[model samples]
Target: MNTVTRPRILVVGAGFAGVECVRRLERKLSPDEADVTLVTPFAYQLYLPLLPQVASGVLTPQSIAVSLRRSKKYRTRIIPGGAIGVDLKSKVCVIRTITDEIINEPYDYIVLAPGSITRTFDIPGLTEHAFGMKTLAEAAYIRDHVISQLDLADASQDPAERAARLQFVVVGGGYAGTETAACLQKLTHAAVKRYPRIDPSLIKWHLIDIAPKLMPELGDKLGHSAQEILRRRGIDVSLGVSIEKAGPEEVTFTDGRVIPTRTLIWTAGVVASPLIATLGAETVRGRLAVTAEMTLPGQDGVFALGDSAAVPDKAKDDDSAICPPTAQHAMRQGKVVADNVIATLRGQALKPYVHKDLGLVVDLGGTDAVSKPLGIELRGLPAQFAARGYHWAALRTNVAKVRVATNWTLNAIAGDDFVRTGFQARKPAKLKDFEYTDAYLTPEQVRKQVEGTRALDQ
Candidate 1:
């Protein structure tokens, strides 16, 4: 809230893109050039690629979260909240603090990097019964839930209840789904070893996806190899199938198969944050549309990036081919956006964002993994090494890197502690209601609702 003559730069969201943008700006800009403020729901940058590792108990939740204050060099004022509304015409952004207090602040430059949320479908009982794996809290909840499920199954006398508790179903064939299934399966495998009364063979892990291949983004060859690895570990890989319904103790698949399962993890996909819709800007697939330079066309001093922005992939020839919303692209786009912002401020030319695909690595827990680096395909332990090392290098700070590395080493040496955190004690939250909205209404809609209620009372 400094009244310096320098322009104020307000960056929203602390995901890979926003965090990197702030980091670059702090390095490039002089102290007196501009005042940078970053608003996020959390105080850390989540290494999303390794989120499954956290759920599987392979790494502590904090291992994947880099403290924004420490890594950001204190150059940027970190506001712990999300931007609720933005008045682009007035250059004012209304942010809701963590305490649920709304504060309006005017900004000279606005960067919308508010990341995507879980893309849920209208499957029956899904919202009421299934779990979601998107944040550190969710992942931690999953770890505890899985381990507790095993414990509950062992203690239960009813055969049907035990079966339901033992069967785990994960929907989505993307990296998040596959890794969550793989890592949690490994955790269960290890935890069951400690439970002498539990039968490992009776426990079932079913990965259901509408796609024909697991990890389709990793290409067909590596995808097949990854599936084989999971199948070898006694996992049921159901491709070209989707969950038609879910219940507290059962799930029915679109393939006409019914299975008993207490744990239904939904990692299907992501859509842009509701914040993007509030922008009142043209969007592609729910993401704000941005130019090759990551700027909102005709919206001066406004920039957007990450999963929330549908930026053109200049590496591709077709103008319609927008960049895929991935952490890789987001991290790269952040630096580009920062440079472009600086360029504009200095009256210099702007550069376009462009990067070729470097292939992908899918970690399948333990020594099993599949990867394509620089178009070179790899599998098994080598792939796992590549996957972990890739994420380690991609993390924002050395402290985070060391912490993640140390956690991995400890896990290897000490083995997994299959204790449940009991965080999932509450009833399953509806998928559509995951964002924790107060009135479950937008800023504009809430005012109308309040006014209508007041008139009715009068």
Candidate 2:
């Protein structure tokens, strides 16, 4: 009897792509065929689509943070660290553990899905003053910050200080910024009730984007409709405008308007993980350029997907079109890559990734939403149902699904007490406070770590 050789497969990330791939691989690959390992900073896959809801007190962090340990199907080894670099020639990945210890991991097949970091610009004070919506902690912190502002404003006798605390600014009119602004605005609207001394009119939210349109991908009709919806709700919807200077107490806009504000949430955009740059591969707009198969053009046993790689969009005739970094695409790309990995191990033909746009959903708290599901545009209560329904259905685990459903039901019935958990209350909630973009190893550092250790043994 011949024994099947087990190949080492290393998956980097616990995001939509990495988790899906790992789950699929564990289910399909026989115990004797492949040994799978996952590397991540956290032990759970964060459901990013509904993250804004977490900020608005609609869902708990545990509901969206699907644990990797509770898997009844997967038996893969989980590494509580982040992949800082990958040395392709040596088939080695350098990782920095949560405890701040560094280690080297070798693999036969490597999948780069380290996900993305918040995109920032050269704007001054942006990092020091601006809050982010990229992580679970940031979302929770922002919620507490919003509530704290209301409490401070209600207690303050100085009108200027109260106004500054009550005024909020959100940069980026895309789905994240828009939803964040809308949801948090709703939170403040509800929270102001608890503070009887505070005036609801003092609470102002301004949503601005340098681009001419708000979520242009939603097309002209839906875009205008979404903007109008926000305007009617007392939100200042400004287009082709952005903040020039962000300060702890005030911000100056490019339109020559100086706004007194303390809360500035920046969800402008995201770039690929810096880990991709460590491969010394050519990138498309900071993301690795890959074939339709989600594999490197010339690198064997190497694959990149999700936000880390720019996978070609075969659905579009334009050669330059690459898949957008949406969870919908990332999830499907994961399934394709898993099959291809198994195929390569079995010496079978690898399959290329291909999928159609499944449409988009934008929940705006309460009974407001704008969703284009299956090319059908929906709004108001119908859209809200569709949006939340889609998110509830997309949750990977039954435990997560149940928790989210229960949270939604309870919040709708009894309503939130609007209590701030103060999880990281002492820590300043700023862009620099949450993001660790510069912590990754450079290609030279990666090669040295993998090679220098080899020379020491020799």
Candidate 3:
């Protein structure tokens, strides 16, 4: 008697792309047809757009982290590990588990969607001094750190020290930077009221960016409106400027203005995951090169998407255009890739990925927001509605939606309590502490390690 073997599918990452791909595969494929496995460090899908709100105390981390086990309908095996390297020739992925154990996972079909890391330049003292807004831990840490600053400043009698502690600087003019500045400024503004000894004027927030304009995608009028709102709220908006150097107590700008501060939030940009480079495949700007169908050319049974893949944009006539790394594109590409994977498995023709732009939404905290949903520009309350509405709709689970909506309602009515959680006192949460970019193995190292492991197994 002959037995049939199920095809093994491995998906890396738990972000917008990987999660969506797993969900689609679980729904479309039968248990006997394919055995699906997901490799990620965390078990939840992080709704990254709401991370600023988490830092601002408008929403809790759990509210945005959709659990992988929430639905019992799917039977995908979850591996609590991050893929550090992949040996394309051997069809083996090297993963570092949460327990620090290195294991090689073999797959018949693989999906690479490990997402991105915060892009940093070779600026002096930047990594050691600055904080990032990329992860859930970072958001929670920032909240506690901000409140700790207020607590320390209130206790200090020295004028210069208090002023330095109160001063905050945010670098980057993109969506993450803009929203982080707006939300955190609101947090500090409201938090200052609790400290009777501290003067509100001493608390200063400076937002600087190398770009000439803020959120250039928001169009001229809407972008200007956003800038006006931030400026009116007392945030010092500096355009075409960036940090020249950073230190423990002060940051010097490129224009030679030095400001003393304990807090420096770096939200400049993100590059594709380091795991992409370990494949030794062709890449476009650090992202793996993939066809319009989301498949790796010349590599059978492999697909890549999300922030880690430079998927060709078929919506444009120019072959040079690739899909921008955004949650919208990631989510849509996941479904397309899953469908294509299934098509390949069943010996059916695969379809190319094509989608129209859905516009963008930037929530400026409080009632101010800017959005251009479906090409219609809006600002203020209407834009706020659209922004929040879009995010609310984007939540993958009903439980997440309820929690977020409830958080919004409670935050509006009860307001932030401005309590310090003592996270900084336990351990420092600097840029170096969060992202483990140094953990990745080089392509040669990966091949050597895999070969050694295979020899041992044999």
Candidate 4:
């Protein structure tokens, strides 16, 4: 009987943590030593920070999403699927392929970095009424949805319908919400110029959050500046506000204010993916409890990181302090986890994960931005430069970097081509209830329809 000698390492998800870990492992381990496999639904690592730009026509979607296959130096098999279940005791992972086929793959070592899903509350009508901005597909949908609303407003004869179509409401004032609101607002302003019949003033942008300040983690002065910038642009920056209900064409806030808008973008927050719950390990608020070394206690050869893991921040003295869920921590944790994995294989000591919080940057479209890098607060164009430069440098691929840069350059030189594809609007469901289903039946559906027609004729 022949035996496979090399220990197989399976890394789940192709986000920041999984991709960086795989990249490092490939560089550290020789092909003869161990076999590595990366499983993810998509064959790319999305640079999520710039997704708002994609929605605003400033950058193409592909530019921000880097191809995993491009890096061939890694002797890793790219498996396209999302892991649905993990039997820690049996060292097996059950994954559902893109084609909806379920396969169980046994592994010697496993790294969990499946990232997160949008955290939804039990708010009335939210699931069917509000659109989210957690993935590339969502971002693309938002771009088309916003543009189509404008197009409809221009053609509609009813004043109320036109006003409703033009009004845009963005829930949550976090980094994602702020950026989406800012960038989309700019897109509308630029596009409305082409529609001579429509007044730009008819377009209304409302940014509301339950919190008192926008991006509260960024500290006071900077957060204040951010709110001021949005207000100056005529955005209704409402604080301490919550959505009471959202319907197909209207949204009412807890403050007794009601808005009839076609667009309701939900960027409230993120929670761990449901996959994490199946691990049967200790978790902190839905995130897998991981030690400073990014390993689950008593779970041999199993490690986790990213938004799904509750990793303790060793930099803080308090035992209760856990690391903040940010791309920065996830990216750094990936490198550390890779190093620790190699150390374990070689009988070396593992290093602990510890990182200080770097300041954040909020790009509020065009030259408008708010940033605090190295404790220095900056606003306006300076902040914009920092915001763009930081994200530009963080991209994994050179091709992606250049593509994003070119897109920004082009957008600056010219204005947004705010043309609605009208493809997305034709879907039977509302934008919020949009789900990427394999059952959509594209070419296959057409073929079956034609075959049925021939049978009827015969």
Candidate 5:
């Protein structure tokens, strides 16, 4: 008797792209045709756009983290691990499991969607003293840390120490940075009312960016509108400046200004995952270069998309332009990649990925927001409605949408109680603690490790 083997498809990361791809593949392919496997460190798909709300205690972490096992159509074998390296020659990927075990996973078709990491410069003391907003834990930790600062400032008798503890500096004026500052500033502003000893004026927030304008993608009019809203709310908006040096209790800027603050939130930007470099493939601006069909040039059955791939923007009619890294693009690209993969398996024609630009939205916390959807600029409650409405619709699961909406409604009526969850007291939440960039193996190391594992199995 002869038996047929099913083709195995391996996807790395469980971000928006990886999760969407797996969901589509499960719907399209029968069990007999193909087997799907997802490699990730967590069992949930994190809703990243609302991370600022999580940090500000507006939403619970579980509300934004949609579980992978919730769907009845989920047939993919979930491997609780993160891919560290891929050996293109051997068609194997090295993964570091949550328990720190190393294993090599071989595949017939591979999808790289590992996503980007927090981009950091070589400024002194940055890695040691700064906090990142990339992960769920980071957001939760930031909430606790912000509250604890208030608790400490109220108890301190020394004026200098109290001021240092009260002053907060947020670097980066992008969407993440801007929202983080806006949300957390509201958090501090509300929490200070409880501390009768600590005057609200002592709690200062400084938002600085190297760019000349804020949310420049929103155009000059709306961007300035966001700046004015923040300014009126008492946030010091500084443009065309950035951090030159960082210390434990103070930071110096390139403009030769030093501010004392124990909290320094870094949301500067992101770079493509280092895992892409392990494949020894061509890359553009640190992202894996791919054709319009989202396939590598010479590597068969290998594909890349999302933040890790520099996919060409066919809509612009410019060969030099690639799609910008955003949740909107990543989610759509995943569906297209899944279709193309099915086409490859069925011996059909592949489709090129092209999308029209959806305008940007920035939620500045509370009733202040700025948005430009389909080229019509809006602000105040109308913009806030559009911003929240877009995110509420974009949430993947219905349960997530309901939970997020309830949280928003409750927060508006009840307001935050400013309670510290004591997450930071158990473990220090710094940049180095969250991201494990050094956990992956090199290409040479992957080859040797896989060969050794095979020898042991034999």
Candidate 6:
């Protein structure tokens, strides 16, 4: 191995944690100190909370995609690709770039924050039929798909076909599924007016989940309030039931009822990135087990955080309790990890990750909303105001904040045009297509890649 000169720092992923880590590193580290590089499939940090709005045409894709290059403070090297594997012993990361070129990148210190993927179950035809809401492309494609359904239903002469096209099902009643159902239902409710041939009464949006309660974290009263809001909007909210089987034309629910619909959105939960498995490390329910300091236990110069790491919550005083995978926690965890990385370089003490819960927000696509900011419950416009206010403040950049604010203002005043972008037309829109489940390399493959690169070097 060549003698080390300046320390090389590499951060994986572009989600809240990875982006914030890179930003803070660039801000804190001097030019002559350490060279920082970021590896990600996209160059933007997606604001996940507002993705339902994107799919419903309330916000443009760029409005929620916070660009990493927009940083005026420091310029970190960008590798436009997704990381596949890493060899901690050799300090090398295997990456598949935009052009599919496989390159081995070496680093002195590496941060693994590759984020999570859309969690799906073993239900039949789930991947083939359901659509995801994780990425910007998926969100945009869903908008087109929903609009196309309306058009197809309007032009169909067959009664069964029209009914199938107009009926939509969204699984998982948590924040993602509930908000998605609410926003998209509102879309169809408004857009059907433009379809003079189609009867608005035929339009149906059902939100279902296996859990007994909807957003139980919001407390009973607030959860019920949110459920009432959706119910009043004509949404069929079903609980304690899930999909028994998913088919192209219909879905059989666990409650022994079959619903005919062409659209199925899956937003149940998330699992850590498949890259986590390549490390062959101990995982807590699929997430890499990490200390309170967010470091890989017993692995020097390696770190993990975000949704991919099971970081113990020091403030909670519970050993089994780990920090929940939320954007708020991820963002704060990123800064702490960055500081620790800097401290490691300076031979200083490492601090554990700890913080109080800032609460949760669920925007139901209008003045109807619910929030629990710092244990205080809110509902209706007060909750809406509190929710949006909190999100607007949490946005990392001024430009992102302005774009989001403008989109909200325009969406409210002018309303959605109900026009499809058509960019995703002729494209396969399904869960299997969007989730890169098979992208990661095996542990042996990671070792081979690094070894092969070293052989060529020698």
Reference-based lDDT, each prediction? 0.85, 0.91, 0.94, 0.85, 0.92, 0.92
The Cα error of candidate 3 at residue 236, in Å, is 0.7
TM-score of 1: 0.93
- Best-fitting candidate, scored by lDDT: 3
Worst 10 residues of 4 by lDDT: 436-445
Which segments of candidate 3 are over 4 A away from where they belong? 1-3
How close to the true structure is residue 233 of candidate 5, measured as C-alpha lDDT?
82
lDDT of 2 by residue, 264-363 (tens): 9999999999898899998999999998999898888999999989999998899899999999999999999999999888899988888889899999
Scored against the true structure, residue 96 in model 1 reaches a CA lDDT of 80
Comparing 4 with 6 on TM-score, the higher-scoring candidate is 6
Candidate 2: worst 10 consecutive residues by lDDT?
66-75
Tens digit per residue, CA lDDT, model 5, 191-229: 888899998998899999999999888899998998998
lDDT of 3 by residue, 263-335 (tens): 9999999999999999999999889999999999999999999999999999899889999889999999999
- Every candidate's CA RMSD: 3.7, 1.6, 1.0, 7.4, 1.1, 1.5
lDDT, candidate 1, residue 84?
Answer: 73
Score candidate 6 by lDDT. 0.92
Better of 3 and 5 by lDDT: 3
RMSD of 5: 1.1
What value does the lDDT take at residue 191 in candidate 6? Answer: 94
Mark the regions of model 6 whose C-alpha exceeds 4 Å error after superposition.
1-4
After superposition, which runs of candidate 4 have C-alpha atoms over 4 Å from their true positions?
1-4, 422-425, 428-458
